[model samples]
Target: MRISDVLEKFDISSEREDYATIHDIVESGIVFKGTNLWILIFAILIASVGLNVNSTAVIIGAMLISPLMGPILGMGYSIATYDFPLLKKAFVNYLFAVVAGLLTSAAYFYITPIYQAHSELLARTQPTIYDVIIALVGGLAGIVAISSKLKGNVIPGVAIATALMPPLCTAGYGLATANWPFFFGALYLLTINTVFIGSATLFTVRLLRYPIRFLANESQKNMANRWVTFIVLLTTVPSIYYGYVLVQKENFTQNANNFIQNESFIEGDYLLKTELDANRKQIRLIYGGKTISEEEKTRLSQRKNIYGLAGVSIIVQQGFSVSEINKELSLSDRYQAEINRLKSELSHNIQQQDSVIKAQKLGGQLYKEIKPLFPEIDYCSASKQSFFVTSGATRNYTVVVLGSNQPVRTNRDLARITQWLKVRMKSDSLKIYIEKTAI
Candidate 1:
């Protein structure tokens, strides 16, 4: 349908009289207060630990336990039905939850052994149009769940989409780390999520015609409606502005990614940092590489969305190279060929060396038929009267033939030396070869 038709469908003018009052809606959520509060606390604590340890599973578990969705939805219903008293209650409760969640997570982070921030925490610090879209869609779904006569298992699904706890924990981590930008960015993300979800819920409630049964004075009802409009505007303006900011961030990420894809650049050799602040209208792209040229800048500027983003600063610095890009590509075709040649040469040399050594040890004709009992000796010095044999992978052998002129006296002595060598080698790949050298 057209935009006009869609708007009309959700508009208050199109709403039915069976609408439930904000008071009743708020009352329903209160029943879960103890359960919600405990869950909120648990989720925040788990999220805080997840941020500290960088565990995604822990953070998700915390998200499941968090009871934050209720108050946010409460705020939406209060506004939709023009119930000022209910609205006030929701606003206060929501504020309390946000503060409690943040403080609890921060306190936990302060005491946790893991000081390093995880990817999950960093992910929360960036708000984009995509986040607004998620909140909007989730809000509609949450409102639908509340209004439906058939209450299905929507809580698990709603909890994942609304994502109330992770951002709070992320903000807490930022506070603990004393990172001002991280704290502010994460707070903005949380704010965007709340406003969009609440507003979307209001829109859905108006569309679905959920009953407003509580009677009120005409004057009070009018005043409440006016107040709701004002509050909705208050939430909407900031969200629209932040959506613009998200656009700028998208541009920066796209440009940075494009720069790295150039044939002259090695993909994994450099790290890119793209920071775009829409309020400041400043975009900064820092990359580890030799100086980028005017051509590269022009290529980035070619992006239509990026062109609108002003104050763009690009910094490229020198970094180590694993291999030059052009040379690496050129050699790739011959890589397997080179490897095979090296392997064959190595195998042939090993066979020839063993044959010569065996013949020389044989001496006149069958090498005096003396079994070379200890082939693998670490160090041997006949003059010093010291023979040190180390353990090989297969067996350990120590040959302490006291008189260097003769091989180890007994088969048992030779076997003991082999065993010793094997234990010393500590390698599963090695085999024991006993060789006796004349003193």
Candidate 2:
């Protein structure tokens, strides 16, 4: 077959909808008039519930169904076509939709039983460089898919990836809970999604050479251009800074984690809890059984440069043992006090909302997965300790502490278990602590 025929047979670019057609396609979705308004409102509720329940599937469905992307795409279209009227209309509608979304989510969360921000919610709080990249790429895909008659299959995936629905819900949760840091952080995330996605669409539309329909007067056009330039700078500069901060945090986290892996585990030293404060430029590691020595500390400090840490402070916070209920040994008041402090600090925000259900499922899964590997360890307790992953994932890890005196698993076994958890949990950060104790 001919090359053209071959390309056509593949149906690539053959099914593309034209410029005007694409305009109409997105334009039709611009209205929040009657049923569409209700759909958006309902979608907000669904998204909020999904976040509340920490259900990824439900949130994806909400993102797909929500019309939040319509106006964002329209704003991009207006810029691409230089239609001032369309831009104004789309902007107003977009603002209104945002308010509607935030309010709906806030109301739902206010009345709902769940108060804590789970993995789903926390994931949206800080927009990373990767999110910007995804939004940009997703926008391009969305525009291309829209420009193609083969739009149906690609659009939903774009919606899910773009995540147009979740940030607003997260912001709403923050608002309801009065967590200003979370609220503003989520808003910043939403802003990133909005700006980059719209920018990408505009880029795609210009690339496709979409004609300027109903062009503004020359004077008005100049004013519009200036305003657009200002808006672009306003939205983009902070995003660049935020992206930079995210990268720094990510690097700091890696170095801190490396330090913990190398230095935290000693003959008599084990980490009770470790806190990395990016704002304070410090890593506070709490150890149990024994405090880290000055010589060891000096060694860690020297390796700081090797680990990409130069100015960051490393504080070896003295910690008490986080031991299980040891029927073997009755502890004194001092030991009890230490344990209490350790428990309080380590367990801080350890359990989030809707974790009860998750714990049950994970418990079973951990046992099943671990049983085949080491059948000797009679008791295996797994709980998750999660913080923001700084960039991509939920930033969560499963902490599996095996309680047994005779561990058939060696250090190699422990390493293998960690790898298994990482692979199984899809989390790169897994902590496995072995407590040598008799039942």
Over 299-321, each residue of candidate 2 has an lDDT whose tens digit, in order, gives: 76777777777898988765355
Model 2 TM-score?
A: 0.66
User: What's the TM-score of every candidate structure?
Assistant: 0.54, 0.66
RMSD of 1: 22.0
**Residue 320 accuracy (lDDT) in model 2:** 51
User: Which candidate gets the maximum TM-score versus the true structure?
Assistant: 2
| Candidate 2 lDDT score at position 115 | 87
Can you tell me which runs of candidate 2 are displaced by over 4 Å?
Answer: 1-14, 18-20, 265-271, 290-296, 303-305, 318-439
Q: Which segments of candidate 1 are over 4 A away from where they belong?
A: 1-26, 31-33, 214-439
